[model samples]
Target: MYLYKFNDPEKALDCFTAFISRFPESGNITLVYYLAYEAAGKAGKASQAETLKDELIRKFPDSDYAKGLQDPEYFKKVDSDLRTVDRMYAEAYELYQNVYYKEALARCEDILQQFPGSKMSSYVLFLRAMCIVNLQPADEARIALNEVLAAQPTKRIQTVVNGILASMDVGDKPVLYADAEMYDARYLKSVRNWTFDEEKHAENTEEDRENPYKVNKEEEYCVVILLPEDMKTMQVLHLQTRLTFLNAALKAEQKDEKGDYQVKKEDLWYKTTALQIEPFANYGEAAVYLNRVAVDKTLLKNFKGARYRIFAISKTNFSVLKRLKNAEQYVDFFVTNYFDDRGQGEIITGRQGAAAHLFKYEADEKHDFVLMVPYRQVNVKKMAELLHGIEPAFALEKETYDDRYEMVVVKNVGTQVQSMEYLQLVSRNKEIFDRLSGTSSYMFTITQSNLGILLENQNIEEYMKFFDDNYQRNQSGEVGVGDGDFVYAKSVAHKFVLFYPNTIDPFKLKTTFEEFNFAGLMVNNVKYDDEHDCMVVSGFRNKEEAMRYFQTAVDNRKLFRSLRNVDYRNFIISDSNFDTMCEKKEIEQYLQFFKKYYLE
Candidate 1:
C-alpha cells in the first residue's frame, strides 16, 4: 500500500479506498489514506486536494497533516507550505538580478523567518549575504563574506568566494618594518617553513614540527625591513646588525590603540632609517643627514617654501636635480652629487669619477632640433617622408650616448588640417626618419623657408604677426610674379582638381573657383569650330564675368548650338552664396578634397 503512494498516488488513492472498505478496522489504514490524498493534491488535481482534505479530517483527525492545516506555522515547519517558499525564493532571485540588493536581502530574510527548517535555508542565507555585501556598509560586507566562506560551499561557490577574497583588502596588516638582514639565510631559517631550498629543507625538517615558530593563525601582522642586495660585504653586515637592533626596538615600542604594547613603531622607523644609510653609524648623525638631504624640493616649490619633514626618497630625485640646474648650475651639481653618487653610494667622488659624471650629464642636457613649416608652403606628406628617412641616424646615435637629440617637425597649418588627421600621419610614419647618424648628434631642420624665419626668431609674438601680415597681404592683391613694371597674376588653382572634366559650364567653374578664393575665374569662349563641334569656355575673373562670356557664346550660336542649352542658373546661384557658406562648409570640403588628392 505504501508502494502505491510512492509510485502512482492516483492509483494509490483507489487502492487505499478499497483496502479501507475491505478492512475498515486496520490501524494503519488512516495513515495510508492521508498520504494518498496529499499526493493527489500535490499533482495539481483540486478535486483530489479537496477529497484528501475531507478524508484526512474525517478519518485521520489526529494526523500531522490535519493538525498542520489548523496551525499555519505548523504547516511551514513540516514542509507543507512548499508553494509559498518557492514563490518567495523566486521573487528574491528576480530582485537580485535587477540590482535591487536591499529588496533581495529582505525577501531572503523572510524565507528564513517563515520556513526556519526549510531545505532552501542555506541558499537563502547565501543570497542574503551577497545582497548585504553590496547594499550595506563595509563591516556588513566583511561579515557576509566571512559567513559565505565558512559555509563550506560547493566547488563553484568556493571558487567565486576565493576570487572575492583576493580582490578585497580586508584583514590585512600594514607593513610596519622591512630590514634587508631579516631576509638572510639565518633569519629566514628562523621563520618557520620559510626555507631557502624548500626541497632540501623539507627533507631535513620532516622529522621536526612542520612549523615551530607558528604563532596564532588568526593574529595578522607585517614587518618591513631593508634587505641588502648590492652593497659591499662590510656594508651588508652593518645593515644586517642595524636591522636586528631596529627589529628589537620595534617589538619593545609598538602599541595598539588601548596603549598596550602590541607592535613597536620606533623599530619600524629605525629599520627604515637604517635602509636609507649607505653605512650604518650613529643613529643621531644619520637622522640629521637624512633630514637635510631628504628634503623634497618638488613639495617645497608646490607649497611655496613650506618646511616639511622628509619621510621617503623616490626615483624622481634624478629629475629634480636636472630641474635645479635650470635655476643655477652650481646648485644642480651640488644636488646631483648629494643624491646621485654620494647619497646613493653608486660611485666614488674623484677626478675620474667626476669626469665620467660630467660627460654623462652633458649628454643628457643636449637639445633637440625643432623644424617649423608653413602649411601653405609645403606638402605634409613630402615633409614627413624626408623626416622619416633620417630616423636611422637618430636610432644609431641613441645606442651610444646617454644624451639624445630629436627632430621635432611642426607644420604651421593653422586650422586648415584636422589635428587628429595630422597626428595619425606623423605617428604612423615617425619610425622611418626619426634618428641621428655617426657622431654628429645634430638633427636636421627641414621645413618651409617662411617658417625658418619664425624659428630663427623663437618669438611667438613675432610668428603671430608674420602669419597675420602674410594673410592680409595675400588677400589685398592677387599673388603674382614681379617682372620689371608688370605683375603677372599667378594661377592659384588646386594642383589636384575635383570637378568632372569636359563638362565645364563657365558659370559653375567661376563659382567653384570664387568659393575657394582662386586667383582667376572662368569665362565661356564665343568662338567654336564646326569640325570639333564644341564651344570653348575659359575660367577668367569672377562669376558675373564668366556668365557674360557664356551668354556671348549663346547669343552668337555660330559656335555649337548645344552649348547654348547648358544650364548656367545653378552656377550663378552657387557663386553668390559661396562666401557666406565657405567659412562653415567649404573648408571641410577642401580638406577632404586635399586628403583624397594627396594623403590617400
Candidate 2:
C-alpha cells in the first residue's frame, strides 16, 4: 500500500513476487493476481504483463479481470493512449534540449497524471525529476529525485542524480573576505567554517564576549587595512592593531541634526588615526574617499606621515567576503589606482612648471596617480596642450552631482605607462611649459572668468608682465606668488640637508620618500643621533643648483604655517615648521631638544 501511494509500481511488483512464492495455493490471492498484472504493465515489463494476462484468463476465466482482457476495443484504446504518451515524452525532451525546463516540467506532470498506470510511467517520472533540476532549488528538487529512486529507476538515471547531489554541498564553493562585495566581483569564494566544532564555537563565543562591540550575526562591516606588498609584516600588524583600537576607543565630537557624525581631529583618542578613514558602503564611496585623501595633504599628516590604505565592506556577511580570490582582487585595485592617481596628480598639481627641489618627495611608479578637472568649466585647448606628449584614450566618465563632476575611469593609456615621473621626464616639453606657465601658474583653472577666453588665447609676455605687477603688490598679503616661485637670500652650501623631528620613525620616512622618487633630492647620508633622538638626512648636491627649488619650499612653509589652527606642521615630514628651523640654520636646536631625552 505504501509503495502504491508513492507510485512505486516496480517495488510493488517485487512485493507481489515474494508473496506469491510464499502462498502458492492461497484461495484469497485473486486480488494479488490482478494487481500483479497491473503492476507489471506499469513497471514496463511487457513479457511479464502478457504472461500474467494469459494466466488470469486461462486459469480464472470467470473472474472480472479476465473478462476485461477479452474486450479488443479496450486494448486498441490502450495502444492509442500509449502512442499519445510517446509523443508527449518527445515534446518534453525537445523542450529540455532547448533549456525550457519549466515548460518541460509542466508537460511531464501532465503526462504522469494522464497515463498513471501506463507502462512508460517510470520513465516519465524520471524525466520529471531531472527537469526539476533546472526549475527548482537544489533541496526542493532532491525530493523529486528521491521519489524517482523509490520507483526503482534505471542505474543510469540514479548515477546522474547522485552526481548532482554531490555538487550541491556548500563545502565545495570557494571562500573570500567580507569586504569583497565593494568591487565588481561581489562574491568570490566561501569562508572556512572555523566554528564547525563545539569547542571552536565556544572559543569564538568567549572572544566575542570580550570584544567591545557585540558581533551582530544579522549584518557586519569588515574593515581591512591595505598596505603595499613590500611593506613589512610587523608594520602592517602594528597598523591593524592601532586601527582596531581607534575604532573602539574613539567617538565623534558631535552629531548633526540628521544624525551624521562630525568627527574632529581632537575627538580622536589616537592622534595618528586618519580622519578620512571612514566606513565605505561600496567601492564607489571608497574611490571618492581615497581620491579626496590623495588630494588633501593635511589628511596624510593625520596618520603621522605614514603611507597606508584602508577599505571597508559595507553591510554584508563576513563569511561571504573571506574568499581568497576576492582578497587578491580587492588588493589589486590599490596597486592599479596608486599609479593611475600619480599620473593625474602631476598634471593637476602643475608640478612641471616648478624646479624639482621644491618637491620634498618625488613620485615612483607605485604612487597613486590621477587627472582631475575640478568641477568647473575648463579650457579644452589648454587641456589638450597640457597632454601634448601623451596619447589620450577615450575615458568613460561617471557623472556625479548632476554632471558637475565627471569621474574619468582609468584606461590602458594611463595605467600602462611606467610611472608619472617617467612621463614627466620623457614628455616634459619646455616650449609647452613656457607657453602655459607664462600665462597663468595654475594649469587647471582659467586666468580670467570669461566664458569665451581660453588660456591659450592670452599673450604670454603681456600676461606675465601683468601678473608680476599684481604679484609684487600683494606679495606680503593674500595673493599667492605665481608658479610657486620664490627668491631667497644667497647661502653657502656644497651640499643639501633634510631634517626630520622625532615624532615619526626615520626609516619609515626614508622608505616613503624612496617610493616617491623625489625629483632632484637624493639620500647621500643618514645620521641618527641617540642623544638628540633626531635623524638628519644630508644629500651631496651644490646648493647653488637647487637654490630656487629650496627657496620655494621655504616660501610654501611660511604660507602653510600662517594658516589658522594648522597643527599639521608639527608632524608632517615635508613643509613643516622644521623647515623654519632649517631656514634659521638651527640644526643645533633640533639636536638640543633631542638631547633632553638622551643626554640627561
Candidate 3:
C-alpha cells in the first residue's frame, strides 16, 4: 500500500497480482484485481490490463466489472474512438518531431475530424496551434493561440501558448507603453531597414524538398531619430521625429504625383502693383520654374515614404546640443500650408530634416556629443518633465527656429551615470515599478541588469548572495512564484558559485549523485569539503529522510555500488542507457522497496 501510494505502479502491480492469485476465492479478490488492472494501465501494460479484465469477467460474471464489460455501449464507443485518436496523435507527434509542421497540422486536423468529442481533442488542438506557429504565419498563429487560451489548457500547454504569444505582434496597432524604453546603440541601427530574403534552394534529394511556393523577399525598414541635446528629450524626440517624417513624406508625394497644388490669385505675382505694363516676357520659363518646384516637393515627399527607425548612438557624445534650455517648447506642433487649398499640409516638426541628418554623424568616433532638437510640433515642456523624472541630471531649454518656438537640448548632468545607468533610472522611474514591487521587482531588476554590477566588482560572494536571497524570497510565495524565476535564480547560482560540483565524469568520483529533479528538488547551495572526502550538502528541510535513504544504498554494497556508478551527470538520461541497466522487473522491485521504506 505504501509503495502504491508513492507512485511505484509497476511494483504495486506485481504485488497485487500475486495477492489476487493466492486469494482468488476471497471477498477482496475483486477489489485486488481492479487495483492490479489500474496499476497495469498506469505502467503502460495495456495488454496486461486487458488480460485482467478478461479474468474478472470469467471469474465473476455477476460482478460490477463483469456488468461493465457485458453492456459497454458507451465504453465500447469510447474505446474504439480512443484507439484511432491515439494512432493519429502518434502520427502527429512523429511528424512534429521531424519538423514536418504542415504534415503534423494535417494529422492533428484529421484526429479532430475523426474524434470530435474524444478526450484527446484538447491535445490535438494544442498540437495544431504549435504547428501553425512553426508554419511562420503570424495571423494564423494568433488565431490558434487564442483558441488554446479559450480552452482548458494544462500548465505545460499554457506555458507554450504564452511563449508563442509573447513573440507575436497581435491585435490592431501596437501600443507603446510609457515604460517601454528602446535600445539605443549602433548595433540596433541594423534593425532599421532589416531585410529578410527567403531564397528557395531546391535539392535533388527527397529530404531536401523545398517549399512549393517561390519565397518572396521582404524589405522591412525601421525609423530612427535623434534629439538635438538633452538625453531625456531625445528619447521621445527620436520616435516622434520618425512618425512626423513619415506623415510629411506621404502627403508631399501625394500632392506631387496627383498634380494637386493649390493656386492662389494673390500669390500669382510677388509685386503686382510695382510691375508696369511691359512686353510679354517668356512666360514659359516662369511656368517651367513653377513646375520644377512642384516636382522637387513631390520627390522629397516620396523619399520620406520609406520606414524611419530611431536609434541613438551612445558612444558618440552630443554635448554641444545639450546647452539649449531656453529654446521654444516644440515637442508637438502642426505644419500648415496656410495659402494653399488643394496643396494642404499635415502636421510636421520643423526639425525633421535636422533629426534625419544626425544619423550620418552618429558613427563618427571623433565626436563626443550629439544634440537633437525636435520640430516645433513637439511639447518641449511635457517632454522635459518626463526627462527630469527619469534622469534628474538632464536640463531642458527652449529656443526659436525660423521664428517658430522649439525646445533646445541642455546638459544631462546630475549624478554619475553611464548608458545602462540611464536605462535603469528610466526603468525604475517608469510605471512598471508600481506593478512589480519588493522581491518581484528586485528579481526582475537583477535579471535585467545581467549581473552588470557584480561583473564590475568581480565579487563572487555578492553574486552568490544575490541568488540566495532571491531564491528564498521566491519560495515564500505560493501563488506568485514561477518556474521561470526559479530557473533564472538557479542559472545565476550556477554561473557564480565555485563550490558546486561544476563538472561530472565517470572516472572522477567513486559514487554517483542523482540528478536534481527541477520539479521536486530545491537546493540552497553546494559546499565542498576536502577534509572529509565528502560534500556537505545543506539547507534542505528533509535532510534526515534523505540521509536515511542514502544509508540503505550504503548497506547493500553491490547494489549500492551499482546504483552509485550510475552517471546522472546530464539532467536527463538516455533511453538506451536506462533500458540497459534496469529491466522493467528490476526497476519495479527497486522502486517498490525505495518507496515503501526510503521515502518519508
Candidate 4:
C-alpha cells in the first residue's frame, strides 16, 4: 500500500503476493487480495490481472471485495473521487489532535477559502469553530459556530456544534496553552515550502530554445513587500486580498484579446508569509506599482496593519531567495548584491561579465558571404503560388531567412555579375516583384554574411547603409506596395503514407477510422485524413501495417473513392542539410534520407 501510494505499483504487488503466501490462513486476507488486484491492473500485467480476478471471484465469492469487482470501472471511479482537500483535512485534523489549536484554525480557514466547493468544507468549518471558541471573544466564536450550522453539517457534526455553543454560553475557561515559541519557518510553512523554479522556467520560455545558455544579469525585476513578522493568519490573508484587488483594478484598465474562455477554474493561491509581485518591465515600473499600493486611498482602508517596507529586487538575487524558500533571505541577498540606499532603478551592473554568454552573442571568428538574389516576404507560400508560373527563377528557391522569415531565393546564380544581372532582371520587371511580394518585403542582393549581420544587430538603417556602400546600381532592391507580412515555419519530418487518387470525402474517411482501430499509428493520425483529395495517414509506422491499410479502403469503397497505391512524383524534406545539398541542383542526400525514412 505504501509503495503503491508513492507510484511503485509493481513492487507493491510483489509485497502483497509475498504477504499472502506467508500468511494464507489470516482472517482478513481478502483485504490484501483486493488491494493486490488494483496494483496488478495498475502495473499493466494482463495475465496477472486475470489471475487475481479469478482468485477474488472463485475463492472470496461472498466477500464485499468480489461484489465490488462486478462494476468494471470501480477502481477508476475510486481514484478520481479522492480529492486533494481530503488529504488537507487530514493534515489539519492531525494538527488539532496534537493540541495546536491556532495552527488548526489557520489551516481550516485556508481550506475553506481555497476550496469553497469542497465536500469537506462544513467539516473544516466545524473544526474552525472549535479553535476560535478557545482563543477569540464569545461573539466572534459564536458567529463562526452559527455559520457552520447554516452549512447544514452531518448529524455527528451538528452534535459537536451544539456542544460547543452550550459551552460558550456558560463562559467556560480555556484549554491548555503552549507558552514557548515554535520554529518560525514551520509557522510560515506556506511561503517557506514554496520555491520558484527559475532555471526550469527559463528553459521552458520560447526565446531560450535559441542559445538557451544566454543569460541576462540585469533585466526582469519584481516588487517585494516585507511582511510584518508576528502577524496573525487573518491579517496576512487580508493584506494579500487587498493587494490582489489592487492588481485586478490595475489590469482592468488595460486592454486584452477579447474572448470569454470556458475553462476548469482552479483557485491557484497559497497563503504567503512574505509577498512578492512580479514581471514589471523594469525597476521604474515596479516602483510605480509599489508606491501606489502604499498611499492609494482605496487601499488604505483594508491595510490597517503596520507599514511594511516595499522595494524592488533584481531577478538574480530575488530568484536566489525564492530558490532557498526563505523569504527573509531576500533582505540578506539584496544588501549583499544590488541593494543600495539609492533609488529602485540603481542596480550595480558589473556581474554581466560572469554571465556574459547569457546576455550577448559569441561570434569570435571572421567570416565572408557569397552573393545571392534572395527576396524575403511575410507570405512566402503566396509568393510561391503567384510567381511559380511567371518565371521558374522567381519561385525556384524558398528557404529560411533567419528565424523570423523565410525567403524565395535565386539558386545557381553564381558570381557577383550573375547575381547583379538576375537582380536587375527582377528589378526592371517591378510589377512581377510587386505581385510576388504581398506586403512588407526585403528584395536585395544579400549575402550570407549580410543576413548574419542583420540577424545579430537587427538595425535596418545600418544594413541599408552597408548595402549602398558595397553594391552597385544593378544590385538595387525595392520594397513591396503593401506591408509584407513576416512568415516563419518550423518543419518536422513525418513519414506519412499518402494516396492522392481522383478522390475521398474526409468526413466518411474519419467516420470509418472511428469505427475501427488501426494498428501502427497514433490517435491524432487515426482521427482524420491529412487533406482533401488525398489520404495521408500516420507517421513512423511499419510498411506492412500501412500495406494492410489498403485492404480497409478496398473493404469500404464508399469511404475511399477509387483510391489506389501509386508512386508520388515528389517527396518533401525539411532539414537544412538536405536544403544546402539541394541548393546546387543536387538531391542525393534527400534521395537517401527521404527514400530511407519517408514511408517506413
lDDT of 4: 0.49
TM-score of the candidate numbered 4? Answer: 0.20
Q: Indicate whether candidate 2 or candidate 3 has the larger lDDT.
A: 2
- lDDT per residue for candidate 2 within 1-600, as digits (tens), equals 423445777887876666567866644244456677778989999899788888878888875457667874654565477668877977776555434566778999999888886656767777887777655666667788788877775555567666766666643322221223322121111111111234656876786454222223224233343343233322333343333223222322224322111221111110112222444444454444334334343222233322344443344422333322243343333343433665343322222211111122221212221233334444434545445334444332222312333222223222212333323332244443344332312322111121012122332232222222322222332221111222111121222334444444434434333322233344322333432223222242323444444455445544233233422222112222234444555555544443332123
Tens digits of per-residue lDDT for model 4 on 1-600? 234326777987886788679877654366667667877888898789779888988998876467567765644443343345655766676566444678878888888887774556777888888778666777888899999999987666687788878976798744534433222323344233222235435655754244212123357666666554344433444455456446545664557621111111111112233566766766566656656665553333233333334456667755454444544344434434444543221112111111111122213322222212234434556655544544554325665544555556554443555555555455445455445433444555555455555556444444443343344423333211211121011122232223343344334443344234333342121111223232334443233344355445446655443243433222333323323433443434445544543343
Please, what is the TM-score per model? 0.18, 0.20, 0.20, 0.20
RMSD of each: 36.3, 33.5, 33.4, 27.4
Question: Once superposed on the true structure, which residue ranges of model 2 sit more than 4 Å away at CA?
Answer: 1-70, 169-600
lDDT of each: 0.38, 0.42, 0.38, 0.49
* Model 1 deviation from the true structure expressed as Cα RMSD, one decimal place: 36.3
Relative to the true structure, candidate 3 reaches a TM of 0.20
Candidate 3 C-alpha lDDT tens digits along 237-257:
223222322233344456444
Query: In model 3, which regions exceed 4 Å deviation?
Result: 1-71, 169-600
**Candidate with best lDDT:** 4
